[model samples]
Target: MNLIAKLLPAIALTAGLSAAQAEGDALHGKQLYAVRCAICHSLDYNGVGPTHKNLIGRRAGSVQGYAYSPALKNSDVVWGEANLKQWLSEPEKFIPGQKMFIAIPDARDRADIVAYLLQAGAQQPSKTP
Candidate 1:
């Protein structure tokens, strides 16, 4: 009974932390994307970078028409929360020799950006240009 009581608080804390990490604000993410990513990327077409529509779960460097670096094009990473977080934190470090150099240092901001990307990607129509 004493062991259970001691373990219960730790379990509750772990659950709370997980919930907090998962609860990213998509609205904030949208704003952050505009400031940080808009210069190089778009949702509907390939600009300086590839379209971000339907980005999650898509394989890295798989978007058509955007010229990708050899390192990125060859990498077999599937986009997901973990991968996105690492990429956002440090793109060059995540995939060496990739063209993208932008990095989001704040973990919370990175989470928000990923959340926004997921939400925006879902809403936007996929386009190729």
Candidate 2:
């Protein structure tokens, strides 16, 4: 009984930690994408940055016609939840030789942007400033 009482709190804490990993809201994500990501990226096509369309699961630097830094071009990184989150959190640190100068900074904002990117290709981008 004594050991079980102590273990209960640990179990509760573990459950709380797991519950913190919630999926971002795609709608709010769209708004975040517009304000933060649209300056250089798009769901439709590439401009200063590569398109986010089909980004998930794609190998880094694989978009056709977009010029990429040699480090990115030669990278083995794949765009998935974990790597994408890290990349958004800190670009230069994520890929040392790459030249991205921006970061989303907030974990929620990053999740929202990533959620938006995952779904934006199937819907029109929301207008935002």
- TM-score of every candidate relative to the true structure: 0.78, 0.75
Best by TM-score: 1
lDDT (tens digit, per residue) of candidate 1 on 80-116? 8789999999899999999887799999999999988
Tell me the TM-score of model 2: 0.75
The global Cα lDDT (0 to 1) of model 1 is 0.88
Off by over 4 Å in 1: 1-21, 123-129
Q: Give the residue spans of candidate 2 off by over 4 A.
A: 1-21, 121-129
Worst 10 residues of 1 by lDDT: 118-127
lDDT of all predictions: 0.88, 0.82
> Which prediction has the highest lDDT against the true structure?
1
Relative to the true structure, candidate 1 reaches a TM of 0.78
